[model samples]
Target: MSLLSMTKTNLKALFHGPYTSQFPLKAREPFANTRGHIDCDLSTCIFCTLCDKKCPTGAISVTRSVKATDTTPEKKGTWSIEPLKCIQCGYCVETCNKNSLIMKGECSEPATENVR
Candidate 1:
């Protein structure tokens, strides 16, 4: 081996840069239109309940006549998501008519259970 090359390799190994995150302790900034989870905007939602029908995991529920504000017409609905149950199949994202649901594309680690 060349004398100069051996010195370069050893120097590079000593200066390892910052790599991974300190996640699960600190929250990261949300990326542009990041799909953390699909939530419903009750004000604009038309009570179509289309998302409820399309969700494969039954994560979303749509309820009409929920009174959030008197000024708004009570065109209410709900979106509930259980991350553990989600298959990440992208069905709900495709079916949303009002762009209420979207895919952020940042994949989350699958949660694991501890057996006693």
Candidate 2:
């Protein structure tokens, strides 16, 4: 483009201000098939640890506790996910056999300075 055209375009952009909406007040709708956050339903979960194993970032942690007398370990314990580390890839949701994991449209909250 010529220098005159470039100058005109720059002036137009400067007068239009930002094209984006005010984020907090007017949130944009997520695109179709967009993966945002991962949520797990512990009730249907068998503690199979598939989600933990399939997660690329090691963001998921599945732990099962067993009693001293029990021969088989109970399908229950801690299931924690680090939102900051997760990539929102939906791999865990696909790997879950019980369909207990879901990819929600809402994204994870931004990490604060106090987060560990």
Q: Candidate 2 on 12-56: residue-level lDDT in tens? A: 989999888989999899986878888988777777788899999
The top-ranked prediction according to TM-score is 2
- Which tens-of-lDDT digit does each residue in 53-97 have in candidate 1? 887878667666556563453434445566666665778778778
* Reference-based lDDT, residue 5, model 1: 65
Q: How close is every model to the real structure, measured as TM-score?
A: 0.53, 0.72
lDDT of each: 0.64, 0.83
Candidate 2 lDDT score at position 45: 78
TM-score, cand. 2 vs. native? 0.72
Clashing residue pairs in candidate 1, if any?
Answer: 35-104
Off by over 4 Å in 1: 1-11, 22-34, 65-79, 87-89, 102-116
